[model samples]
Target: MPVPHERTSKKKFYRSPGGAARVTYIRGKSGRHHCAYCGGLLHGVPHSKGVAGTRALSRSQRRPSALFAGKLCTRCRATAVEEAAKVKSGFKAAEAVELSLKPFVLEAMARVE
Candidate 1:
């Protein structure tokens, strides 16, 4: 029987040289990170086995350096920047921005210019 920590792990059987079957437990992998805005898979992010494995990585390896890198995809980031620029320049109203994009647009507006 597996220990309490490994109770949920998958089991595999292998034949040994002595003709005895050996069982091995395999732990499940963590899910990939997705973008908050586009629901696309995030790039440049490592999927570690658990919290300790993730903590072992450097900050740069854990997430990208770009603004909102881990949270938003490149395409959505670009759109947010464009919308923020238009809103800042009086071409678009803040209220007219899409509900999902409003927070991103506001954040970009404050940071860009």
Candidate 2:
């Protein structure tokens, strides 16, 4: 793949008021844009035609970011929160923890004669 040329600043977009920064992207022979993560095709991605020295927001871009409590999304966003909760032990002052059995706790008590 050709190193995407650093297009002129007039052809890029920056989150801030400044224009000194730049960004990068891929341009296929067919002139189709794709997602950087899954390579899925994208449309209306910000700054596809702006300057070259800034990070362009994808069509799916969300301000403040759902992971940081700025925004929200389905799927991975919720999963991230749950996983973060599980890893909370790392931040706890205690050196060790005792995780109780979940299924066993939920189980019904059988009749004991």
Candidate 3:
């Protein structure tokens, strides 16, 4: 007789499209948090423990910036950056150049007038 396999629910099986690319914290037996993306302990990584601190104190503290490395492991973050750079490189150079030159063109026009 063959054994029947149990079906898993979608809630437990499905992961978001961004899930693989994102960094999440998982509590470990050691009581230290681990990076879900990298499987590395989060101890060495710097993050703001709480938002209760004042703005000045927070600013003085070394916290992750908006574009700073997120919860993902270092390896994952590097891969993500590489992929983004590839996508950005695919953009038309002329469009980028135009955007960069707009301010200079405006300045030149002002000088001329």
lDDT of the candidates, in the order given: 0.89, 0.34, 0.41
Which wins on TM-score, candidate 2 or candidate 3? 3
lDDT of 1 by residue, 27-77 (tens): 778899898888999999888558898889898888899988888989999
Best by TM-score: 1
Name model 2 segments beyond 4 Å from true. Answer: 1-47, 50-65, 68-73, 89-113
Off by over 4 Å in 3: 1-30, 43-62, 65-70, 91-113
Q: Please write out the lDDT profile of model 3 over residues 41-93, one tens digit for every residue.
A: 54343334433432335442433443323354556445444444433456433
Comparing candidate 1 with candidate 2, which one achieves the higher TM-score? Answer: 1
**Residue 82 in model 1: lDDT:** 96
Query: What are the per-residue Cα lDDT tens digits for candidate 2 across 25-103?
Result: 5452333444332344444333334434223544255233333222222333344344344445354322232233221
C-alpha TM-scores of all predictions: 0.78, 0.25, 0.32
> Which has the greatest lDDT?
1
Evaluated at residue 85, the lDDT of candidate 2 is 43
TM-score of 2: 0.25
RMSD of 3: 17.1
